[model samples]
Target: MLYSDKAPDPVGLYPHARRVGNLLFLSGVGPRKKGSKDIPGVTLDNHGNIIAYDIEQQCHAVFENVRFILEASGARWENLVDVTVYLTNMKADFATFNKIYATYFKENQPCRTTVEVNALPTPIAIELKCIAAFEDK
Candidate 1:
């Protein structure tokens, strides 16, 4: 079986959830509003936005955006088994990353790796991509 979801006015990416058999592959989600983009932050609504450039806040926002994807798929963070994080500067943000990560997955603790890169599309600090699964029977 296959599944998908699309929410207008809140995001540009639609069909956010994709299911292949028992596994669900989610796109890299970032915090953004319906008309605008996910620049960074918690205050982003229909019009206003908040810019969260700090590593801690940036990482948290990414995960919070991810949470929406997970929920759309009828799953939760705990359903995640593996994750890949891309960072523009790993050394400067390691501690902050671990701290915010714990708040989201302290118990589930998905297999993950943090890697440093040249940069992302935005000036924001980090981006996260994940894979989640469940029994398909």
Candidate 2:
């Protein structure tokens, strides 16, 4: 099991990542900063409903959180093999997300799947689940 002090706390009771054999499986990572409930680029109303969000900002933050978990699990960014992205508003966010994603994944192109969802566990707009592989040295 792996936990990262630099990554945001998971909404559920789960570690950041778990390593088995040569693979590390990361839990869903969001844009919230470590030890903070305020999600990046998200503006919520008084009732805690999302009023506005910046997909680009959320994308960068979630990627950084994923990096933190991968480092905690003894993996490298280049070792990422797969990524699953969940977006609350695909129609509004997909293009922006793809643009930001390409900038980070220019060299290490992992297999990816993106889907639209109604919402996440938090007010965040984006989340990522990842898998990485490394030699069992």
Candidate 3:
């Protein structure tokens, strides 16, 4: 009964499903809207904006967004086994990023890796991609 149900990723090119016995590997999700959200404030001209945003706020949203995707797929943050974070300004803002991230997976710490990048789909300051695992029941 292992199978992928939904994907949060905008580009549908990637398969959102993978199965191995009782395990499923869902694709990573970001904060970009499938279409658009009219997110307002001080957003990038080409994308949505946050008026009072810092690495902390953005990190929270990114994790929450991934949690939503996992829930839709019948999984939870506790099911996450690995998380990969991408940041445009990692060296400068990562301290706050890790702080916020700690709150989400406080109970279950998964293997994690963060990389610094030059840009992301949106100018939201931070982007997170994760892999979740749930026991088949």
Candidate 4:
């Protein structure tokens, strides 16, 4: 199990990542900054509902969070073998998210699945679940 002080605190009681054999499985990572509840690019209404969000920003932040977990687990970005993306509004956010994703994933094109969901546990617009493979040293 890995817990990263450089990554955001998980919403629930779960480690940032777990290593088994040569594979590292990361729990869902969001756009929130480390040690904070604030989600990047998200603007919440007075009632704590999402009023607006920038998908590009969230994508970058989530990717960074994933990186933090990977580093904590002694894995690299290129080691990612699979990725699952959760989006709150596919129609509004997919294109922006894809554009940003390409910049990070153009070389290491992992198997990816993106899905639209009603919402996340928080007001963030995007989250990522990832699996990575490392050599048994």
Candidate 5:
């Protein structure tokens, strides 16, 4: 079944998450606010060009969005087993993103893979695709 509404409306034709048995696969989540196109920590020029952005802020917003989706599906942050991060500026943002990520995962650090990309669906600097095990094997 499709899951949504706990976070912003998706930017594409996909659900927030898909469940197969006890596992939930979350789509690539970004930092856009619910019900609007505003992205946290992003500074845009008058013509809508990106002037600046804080990776840490974007990262936190993305995680919070993921948290909402997980909670709405009866899962928690600890349930996340894996995460794939996409960044537009790995060289410039990895340290900041890592620092913020450490605060969120703490003892429940899931395996992660981060990669630099050319862009995202939106103008945000980061996005996350995650998986959670909601049931014991």
Candidate 6:
């Protein structure tokens, strides 16, 4: 099944998440707000050059978006089995991201992989791709 709702709409034609059997696979979720092009923490100049940003804010938004998707799919933070994090600047943001991440995942830590990349499709700092498993019927 496909899940999409008031959460940030997918930038592409894909659904926010898809469930195969018990596992729900979420598409890359960014910090962009739903029904708007604005991305949290993104500050642009008149010419669209990034003047400033807050990684912490972006991280929170991304996780909120991920949470919405997970819940919409009948899953929760505890149901997540794995997560893949994409960061535009790992060296600069990893420490901050890790701190915030720990708060959310807490003792229910799932397998995770974080990687640095040149950029995402949008001007956000972080995106999350997650997999969650629902209880078997």
- List per-prediction Cα lDDT, in the order shown: 0.66, 0.91, 0.63, 0.91, 0.90, 0.88
Per model, state how many residue pairs clash: 0, 0, 1, 0, 0, 0
Q: Please identify which of the two predictions, 1 or 3, would achieve the higher TM-score against the true structure.
A: 1
Clashes of 4: 0
For candidate 3, lDDT tens digit of each residue in 84-108?
A: 8887788888888787787777899
TM-score of each: 0.74, 0.97, 0.73, 0.96, 0.94, 0.94
Which segments of candidate 2 are over 4 A away from where they belong? none
Candidate 1 deviant stretches above 4 angstroms: 1-15, 41-52
Alpha-carbon deviation at 26 in model 6, angstroms: 0.1
Give every collision pair in model 5: none
List runs of model 3 lying over 4 Å from the truth.
1-9, 15-20, 33-42, 46-53
- Against the true structure, candidate 3 reaches a TM-score of 0.73
lDDT of 4 by residue, 9-46 (tens): 88798899999999899999998998777788888889
What are the clashing pairs of model 1?
none
Off by over 4 Å in 4: none
- Compose the digit string of candidate 2's lDDT tens values, residues 1-137: 68998998778888999988888899999989998878888899999999999888899999999999888887899999999999999998999999999999999999999999998988989889999999656
Model 3 worst lDDT window (10 residues): 38-47
In candidate 2, where is summed lDDT lowest over 10 consecutive residues? 128-137
TM-score ranking, best first? 2, 4, 6, 5, 1, 3
lDDT of 1 at 119: 64
Question: Which of 3 and 4 is ahead in TM-score?
Answer: 4
TM-score of 2: 0.97
Q: In model 4, which range of ten residues has the least summed lDDT?
A: 34-43
lDDT of 5: 0.90
